[model samples]
Target: MGLLDLKAPSQAGTMTEATGQSSALDPGTPQWSVFGQLTSPVTHPWAIVGETILLPLIAVSLGLWLNPDDPLWVHASFPWAWFAPVVLALRYGPLTGIGGAAMLLLVWLALNLVHPAEFPKLFFLGGLILVMVIGEFSSLWLARARRAEAIQRYLDQRLEFLTHQYYLLRLSHDRLEQDLISRPMAMRDALGAMRNHIATEQMDSDSAGASALLRLLAQYCQLEVAALHYLVDERLQTTAIATLGNTSPLQADDPLIEHAMQTGHLCHIAQSLNQSEQSSRYLIAAPLNNLDGECFGLLLVEQMPFFSLQDETLQTINLLLGYYADSLSMHALAAQIRRKEPDCPPEFAFELQRLWHIRQSSQVSSVVVALEIQSRPGMPDVAQQIQRQKRALDENWLIQDVDRSILATLMPLSGQSAAEGYLSRLEMWAHQKSGQTLAELGIFGHILPLDTDPPLALLQRLNEIAHASAQTRPLRPHA
Candidate 1:
């Protein structure tokens, strides 16, 4: 992920000048140095040893042949002879340098022994050795300096790229926040205005909530298509809400809707190969849950290619859809409650039971259970036990309050037998896995047959039972 690694080969050409400077400082080959084409292939060690020995030998032999009568020929050739050993040490490192230096010394000693009169004096030979040593050390230092410079340049480039990336991320985050926060506020205000217009009982169905929701979603998300669909008998059925530019209706059994209902999350499809076909575009759906945390409908969206649909975007859509779902549920429950019991206060449980059709079936009873755990005095650890219990239960069934007390959930489809089984499993899990004593944790539940009463009455009864059960627990100080 480094900038240099990401750069295209064509773009890399622009960096040639900088690279050449780096190479010049480098101890290795120069940037513009072209390797000589070999007439014959050379082996590695032979190449190193031969190049070191042969170049100097050639220079000395040529010098001697050209100036056969000159006594100073050998001394004049000495400096040129040192060139091969210096190059060998630079290319192959210190050990090879020492080996090449040893070869030159042996040659020097043999020549002196054979023709002592023609050789330079001992003091001069000592001076020449000192010069060769200095040259070898200087080459090593140059190599190290070049490597350090290359590393520094690499770090500098990385820092620059990261700084640019950071600013881009910040701007993107700020824009996303505005879209998520401000759009919802504006929609809520518009809905409030509409509510005022429909305040009179006679104007109930005049304003379209679903249509307004679709419009707000499309405008905020900049979507190519957006719609709201109600789930009818586990099927995705189109409501009076749609904003597709030219797209067809989504299939009844689309996998996207199933995923949303199953996970209670927003699901998305990013691309498709076919344009003329149905479901050929990116799709996102957020499940709409009522106050009881039951999914009632879904908010669907499809967007153009210009926008990048990220996870945060999906979550924002879900939050806005949840708000709309809550509003619609409140209005529907109020209407249903008034029709059932004109004198009663607004009841959530009763409305839910009616909406879920729990009363007409004999197979099961709908139940909601609330459980509270109080740690014993001087208990070793209670917070850990609470966490264990929370994780053990189904995420949909657990409701966390600011206080440590927890609400255990059961759905409309559950019967008395099934609810009891669930509670038993939960109690066993807490005691066995979390080591929570039964007495320390107070457990209670309320069961209502779906067919027996209106939804509001059922909710009231459940609330009353929950309160009564909490009061029975031994009062203790909060942790």
Candidate 2:
């Protein structure tokens, strides 16, 4: 269509109506305000000042128009006309107040220009100066109040952030106390007593280990029904070595028992769990492994009166099972180490020697972190994972307890910051695993600095923690 061509008349109204609708909805448009003349977005510094000048001018015009015969003095000194100047000065500072006052003065002068002698210049100017002074005082206080409000909002946000951080820290500390301080003491005592009982006489057979484990669980955990079963004949058959209560069908090579044995995770079957199902006649079956995480036995228990699988109770049970597993693994590894006298891996031995020399020559600090991965597949996989995730300075090692379940890393000079870096990486790795890898897998670690102890003592400490709980060992310093 030609540039000047117009739509039909009916179409012209539609276009105009459409334009009006769009203009109304457009966010860029400013609304009119009688008080301000125009209300602009906050980005404009002069919008509010415009209100100050316009409102007073309009008031004076109205007052003059309404009473044409009123005295010139009364018209110029209209009380309502002062409202704009006073408010502008209080909110927009003194320059705006002065502008508003000048605008009002011009209104008076314009109306009585023909009679200068009758004009009340001194009276009007004096009153305006006093009003401006009062506005300045009010403005000073308003500025301070606004600044104070901003600061209060900033502080409130900071306080809220700190409160959230503190709450998370408290939860972490409480978990540590429960795992390290309280439960470990009881666990150590029970395991020690079991060791003494078994060591009192010769008990090398699978039957003897089972009896002792049952005893430990009974005495410490107060379990009335449980059994320990191990595989024999090249892992081809299942054998029940001990029993606390009447043997349930779980004593056989049920797939559930085998599943727990293989994964080293705990299984509780009401007929199985978390429906809130499986009911009251459920069973709790946990796998017992040696240091290498080879499922050596299945620990089966028909549900008992006191046996609710809460976190605390489950943790205690796992700790006991772990301690039991570690004891057997420790004995076997000690025998193997004594018989073969294997030195630390060449790389590990070199790192330890270098650190020891540095400690002697200068103020050097080194630490050993033993991470026991639960139901972790094999040393090669664990080694590969650590190798990929480890820091440049970190010297990772897999101390395969004879059964091959525990993994420990010897860090030459890891301080608190370095240690946390490794841990956060490990935490990330744990979270990535889903189906089988995540089934019962857990990573537990402990750190011992060489600041006080020699390299040898630190190694021994790492070995000690290597066999503790494979899921809850704390990375606190050791003496």
Candidate 3:
């Protein structure tokens, strides 16, 4: 038989459909039969040779024991010996079968010469030739079946791996769509709804604003806890102003909070909570920075089941929290500005002059001197002047507008000579401006004591001196 004889039959039409149904019912049936046949061949070279060699040897020994004096009985008993070559051919394949047959023929001829038997030598030779053809065909068919089975198994494994990879790709695509598109849009809509409540006229105070923000963040982000902490600076002693979460307010030592505060970046802790024991889960902290890029506070949020605190999510949270901080800070600053009820007070003016005189007389290690730019011809716009001054003194001093005519600034932790040098730079800047001369403008300044007074009080004193100086010196024309 050729290699085709070994292959499992491919069913046709209705039979194929039936086979598919049967395979579904019994998955391993085909594989079991294929492997079984490969291991146990019906008739092979080894099997035939082994049996032929053992059978004759046993018969001769039995005959010798039964009749020691019967010479004719021994010669006749070996009549079945001619069949040994045929048996070898049936059990083994063509090459091994032919070799076994040749060996048996030589033995039979030698025995016939020694004690001539009645069997024909041609009969044994003809039987061996027939067995060779049959054995060769059977062995060829078995080898072909093994090859087909191996090929089928290899193809099946490849198909399975491809199917698994396809499903995984689909799952990844769905996750990306949900995370990038859906989640962000949902967050925006939620923020808009919260903004409606915040814009209402009745809502006031930082605490109320913080509470509103926390509620919206929790709802949108699916967080279990959300808290806002305000920075409280009490003469360099910083503390938390308000907390809205169930957990204890975060101390200065908390790593997540400290990192957020220091870097003004978002920080997160994964697997920080125990669900069964009711511990805080994942924590995400975003820093709230001012327009000056100074961190004012932190917004701490915690999630259950540990929601992914990815960079994009953290950035969105930071942006929204920053807006809340800006709005609240603006409201507080406006209120504080309104409470200070003075354009220029006499006592403040006298105190400012006294401080300036003391700094000029004393030889202290460090004194902060500041110049008050009362009037300028080109920039009559106060807002524009403030902006320009801010840009100019971005890193130099702490500047603030006291009133319409005066701008007060502090050169913190500096001395009288340094203050004088700062004043000279201000004079040069004033002279450089178009339509303005240094001598033409009334610019009075003062150096105040860094201790024993608040920055706000010092600012108030400077304002008074600036206003008095402006009144004393008449307005100069553009030069």
- Clash number for each model: 14, 6, 8
Model 3, residue 233: distance off in Å is 17
Query: Candidate 2 — which residues are off by over 4 angstroms?
Result: 1-187, 196-206, 232-237, 248-255, 261-263, 271-282, 290-292, 306-309, 337-479
Model 3 TM-score relative to the real fold? 0.33
Model 1, poorest ten-residue lDDT window?
1-10
lDDT, candidate 3, 1-479, per-residue tens: 22222211122223223212123233534555677874454465565556556644454445447754432142354444434344444445566556655655555566568777676545554556566776677567645565455444434433433443343344335545777665554444554554444433223343555666776555445556666666656111133344445655455555565555544555556322311233233366666664334566677765533433443344345445655554444334333332463333222232333334333334222343444454445545633443355322122232344433444343322456655666566666666764445445645556655455543566666445545544574443222
Q: Estimate, for each residue in 285-377, the C-alpha lDDT of model 2 and write its tens digit.
A: 776643234555667776455434343344445555655654554444333222332435433554565566555554456676666655545
Q: Flag regions of model 3 displaced more than 4 Å.
A: 1-206, 212-269, 273-308, 311-378, 382-404, 449-457, 466-479
> What's the residue-level lDDT of 417 in candidate 1?
71
Q: What is the C-alpha RMSD of each candidate to the true structure, in Å?
A: 25.8, 28.8, 35.8
The order by descending lDDT is 2, 1, 3
User: Candidate 1, 160: how far from true, in Å?
Assistant: 44
